[model samples]
Target: MSQSTYTVQGMTCGHCVQSVTEEVGALSGVSHVEVDLPTGLVTITSDSDLSEADVRTAVTEAGYQLAS
Candidate 1:
């Protein structure tokens, strides 16, 4: 598996973590997730090729923005 980290903005609490985790983790190739609220870092584990664009889309769909 491979991993990637994304900075997600507009998350404030555990509910935000849950929301982003569920949305991102449900995508194909996603295997695991770690969200760090203080740093706005979301680490994702995937078993196959997954583009950063897809991750950004997932974050956006969950009502957040992926930091560039």
Candidate 2:
């Protein structure tokens, strides 16, 4: 499995986490998602390496932005 961590902006609560999780988790090969609310960190586990663009798109679709 492959794992990557990213920082996200505009996430302040459980609902935010859920939204991001749902969106990123829907990406192909994604196995798990963990969001750390306090730090705005999102960790994704996948079957293969995920493209940064794909993750950014997923995060955007979830109403958040990946920290640049």
Candidate 1 lDDT by residue in tens digits, 1-68: 99988899999999999999999999998999999999889999999878988998899999999987
Error of 1 at 45 (Å): 0.3
Could you tell me which residue pairs clash in candidate 1? none
lDDT of 1 at 14: 95
Query: What lDDT would each prediction earn against the true structure?
Result: 0.93, 0.98
What TM-score would every model get versus the actual structure?
0.95, 0.98
Clashes of each: 0, 0
Q: What is the lDDT of candidate 1?
A: 0.93
Model 2, position 26: C-alpha lDDT score: 100
TM-score of 2: 0.98
After superposing candidate 1, which stretches have Cα over 4 Å from the reference? none
Cα displacement (Å) at residue 60, model 1: 0.5
Query: C-alpha displacement of 24 in model 2, angstroms?
Result: 0.3
What are the RMSD figures for all models against the true structure?
0.7, 0.4
